[model samples]
Target chain A: MLLQINDVNKQYTNNKVTNTVLDHVSVSVKEGEFISILGPSGCGKSTLLSMVAGLVKPTSGTIMLDGQPIQKPGKDRGMVFQQSALFPWLNVEENVMFPFKKEMNKQEALQKAKHYLQMVQLSNYGKHYPHELSGGMQQRVAIARAFTMDPKVLLMDEPFGALDEQTRTRMHGELERIWLDTKKTVLFVTHSISESIKLSERIIVMGTRPGRIIADIPVTLPRPRRFDAPETIQLEKQINHLLKEEIDKVVKEELSYAENR
Target chain B: MQRIGKQLVFFVGLVIAWELIVRAGGWTPDVMPKPTDVWEAMKRGFSDRTLVYDLQASFTRLFIGLVISLALGTALGILLAKSKTADDTLGALILALQSVPSIVWLPLAIMWFGLNEKAVIFIVVLGGTLVMTINMRMGIKNVPPLYIRAAETMGSKGIDQFIRVILPASVPYAVTGMRLAWAFAWRALMAAEILSTGPGLGYTLKYASDFGDMSLVIAVMILIGVIGSIVDLLLFQRVERNVMKRWGLETN
Candidate 1:
C-alpha cells in the first residue's frame, strides 16, 4: 500500500457541542491508483482529502504514507484546490515553479516548469498572469503547478468543480490524459458521481450525518467509458439511490428544527 | 497635453484676476503683492540661490525621515499582524498614538532633542510612520487565507511563506500607505521646520514675513505648494496606478 488511512475520525466542537465530521473512515490506496471520494455536501469528502494531504489532522487513528505516519503538509503530497489558488503576482511559469524555490537551481526549475506547462498545453501562456487566464485555463495552470512538484500523490479537492459543463468535460479528458502520462496516485474529492465513475479506478461513496464510507465500488470498465453505456448508467443509478436517503435525512432534520423553532 | 493647456489657461485667468483685484481694491503692493510682484520676488530669490538652498535643505530632511519611517513601519506592521498578542496589545496602542497629530509632538520633541535637526526629523518620522503602520497592518490582515494554505502545502512555511506569498500579495496596500506617508511627512516637515533655526522653506517663509518682505513669503509658499503636488500627484500617484493595473486590482 502507498497510503494507509486506518480508522481515522474528526470532530469539531462549538459552544460545547461536539460535532462528528468523520467517523471510522478507513481507506487503503495502492501506488499509482486513481481513487475518487464521492459524496454529497457535508459528507466530509473534502476533509478526507485534506487529511491525506496532511492539511488537517484526524482526531483518532493514523494516516500513514509508505508505513510512516503523516503529520503535516509536505512536498510529497501536492494539493490543488477548487479556487485554482495561483499567486496573482506571479506569471504562469513562475507560479508553477514556486514549489522548487529552494530545492532546485533556477535554470533546472524553469526547464521543469516549462515542461509541465507544455504538458498541460499552456506553453505559450508562460508569461501571462493568473488574472489574464480564463477559469479553465487557470485550473489547468494549477494542475501543472501541482504536477511540477513531482509529488508521490496528488490530492485534488473538486479541482474542476467551478468550471462550466463544456469546460468541465474538456478538463476531465485532460486530467485523464495527464494521469495516464504520470501514473501517480490521485486521490480526488467531488460530489459528482459521474466524474468519479469517469475518472477513478475505484469510487468510495460516503454518506452524511457523521460522514463515513458507505460503499467502495471498483470501476472495471475500459478506458473512455461513455455515460450512455449500460454499466455506467447502472452504476450512476445505484450511487444516486444511496445518496437520496442521505439528502432526505438532511431535509427532514431541517424541517423538524424549523417546526421546533 | 490637452489637460495641461486647459489648466494653464485657467491659471493665467486667475493671475489676471489677482492683478485686477490689486488695482480695484486700492490695496498697497506691500500688503497684497500683485502676481507680477510675486513673480519678480521668485526670480530674485532663485538668482540669489537662497530659495534653492532652502529647497535642498527641506528635501534632504524629508528623504532621510521617509526612509527610516518606511522601514520601521513595515517591520512593525508585519510583527503586529502575525502575532496575536502583539496585535491585541501594541496594535491598539499604535492606533491610539496615530490619532495624535504630528505637530502636537513638537514641544516634547524639542524638550527631548533641544530644538535641533533631530527634533524636526523626529516629527517627520512620527508623521509618516503611523499611517504606514496602519495601512500595512490592514494589508496583511486582508491577504486571502487561501493563498497561505496553497503555499503551505507546497513546502513553504513560516518566514519563507511570508516573504514569498504574503508580502507580494499585500503590495497594493503598501503602495497606498507610502503615498499617504509621503503627504503626511511633507506637511509635518514644514510644520517642524517653521520653529527650528534652519535654512528650509518654512524657516525662510517665517523670516521673510517677520522682516515685512511679503513678496518673498508669498513666493516661498507657492514654491512649497508646487513641489508638494508634483511629488504626490506626479510620482506617488503614477506609481500607485501602475501597481494597481499590474496587480489587476483596478475597480474599473
Candidate 2:
C-alpha cells in the first residue's frame, strides 16, 4: 500500500462539548489508484482529506505514506482545495514555479513550470495573473501547480465544486485525461456522487453523525464512465440508498434544533 | 487622459479667479501677491538657484529619513504582529505615539540633536515610522489564513513562507502605508525646517516672510503644495493602483 489511514478519528471541542467528526475510519490505497470519499455535508470527508494532507491531525490512530508516519505537511503530498487558492501576487507561471524555488535555479523552474502549464493547456496564459483568469482557468493553473511538484499523492477537495455544471463536466474529462497521463495516486473528496463515479476507481461512502465509513465500493467499469450509462445509474442508486438516510438524519437534526431555538 | 484634462481646466480656472480677485480687490502685494508677481519671484528664485539648493537639501533629508523610517518601521511592525509579547507590551505605546503629533517631537528632538540637520531628519523619521509600523502590522495580521495554510501544505514554512507568501500578500497595505508616511513626513520636515532654520522649503518661506518678499513667500508655499501633491499623484498613486489591480483590490 502507498498510503494507509488506519482507525483514524478526529474530534473537536467547543464550549465543553466534545464532537466526534470522524470515527475509526480506515483506508488503504495502492499506488496510482484514484479514490474518492463520497458523503453529504457534515460527514467529515473534507477533514479526512485534510488529515491526509497533514493540515489536520487525527485524534486517534495513524496515517502513513509508504510506511512512514504522516506528520506535518510535506512536499510529498500536494493538495488542491475547492477554491483555486492561487496566490494573487504571482502570475500563473510564477505560481507553478513557487515550489521549485529551493530545488532548482530560475531557468530550470521556468522550464518545469512551462511543461506543467502546457499539460493543463494553459501555455498561452502563463504570463497572466490569477485574477485575470476565469474561475475554471484558475483552478486549472492550481492543478498544474500541484502537479509540477510531482507529489506522491494528489489530494483534491472538490476541486470542481465551485464551477458551473458545464465547466465541472468539462473539468471531469480534463482531470481524467491528466490522471491517465500522469498515473499519480489521487484521493479526491466530493459530495457529488456522479462526479465520484466518473472520476474514481473506488468510492468510499461515508455516513454522518460521528462520520463513519459505511462502504468502500470498487468501480469495476471500464475507463470513461458515462453519466447516463445504466451501470453508472445503478451505482449512484446504491450509494444514494446508503446516503439518503444519513442526509435525512442531518435535516431532521437541524429542523428540531431550529424549532427548539 | 480625461482626468488630466479636467484637472487642467480646473487649475487654469482657479488661477484666473485668483489673479482677477487680487486685481479687482485692490489688495496690496503684501496681502496677496498677483499670480504674475509670484511667478516672477519663482523664476528669480530658480535663476538664483537658492530654491534649487533648498529643493535638493529637502529631498535629501526626506530620502534619508524615509529609508531609516521604512526599515525601522517595517521591522517594528513585523515584531509587533508576529509576537504576542511585543504586541501586548508595545502596541498601546505605538497607538499613543501615533496620536501625538510629530511636531510635538521637535522640542524633544532639539534637546537630543540640538538645532541641526539631524534634528529635522529625526522629526521626519518619527513622522513616518509610527504610521508605517502600524500599517505594516495590520497588513501582516490580515493576510488570509487560507494563503498561509495553502503554503504550509506546499512545504513553504518559516522564513521562506513569511517572505514569499506573507510579505507579497500584504503589498497593498504597505503601499497605502508608504503614501500616508510620505504625507506625514513631508509636513513634519517642513515644520522642523521652519523652527530650526535649515536650508529647506520651510526655511526659505520663513526667510521670504522676514524680508517682506510676499511674492516669494507665496511662491514657496505654492511650490510646497504642488510638489507634495505631485509626489502623491505620480509616485504613490501609480504604485498603489498597480498593486491593487494585481491583487484585485481595485476600488474602481
State residue A217's C-alpha deviation in candidate 1, in Å: 2.6
Model 1, residue A2: what's the lDDT?
A: 93
Writing each residue's lDDT as its tens digit, candidate 1 over A26-126 gives 99999999999999999999998889888898999899998889999999999999999999889999999999876679999999999999999999999
Clash pairs for candidate 2: none
Candidate 2 residue runs with Cα over 4 Å from true position: none
The C-alpha TM-scores of every prediction are: 0.93, 0.96
Q: Candidate 2 local accuracy as lDDT?
A: 0.92
- Which candidate number would show the highest DockQ if scored against the true structure? 2
DockQ of the two-chain complex in candidate 2: 0.73
Candidate 2: how close is chain B to the reference, as a TM-score?
Answer: 0.96
What is candidate 1's DockQ?
0.65
Clashing pairs in 1: none
Output the worst ten-in-a-row residue range by lDDT, candidate 1 chain B. Answer: B242-251
Give residue A155's error in model 1 in angstroms. 0.8
| lDDT of every predicted structure (CA atoms) | 0.92, 0.92
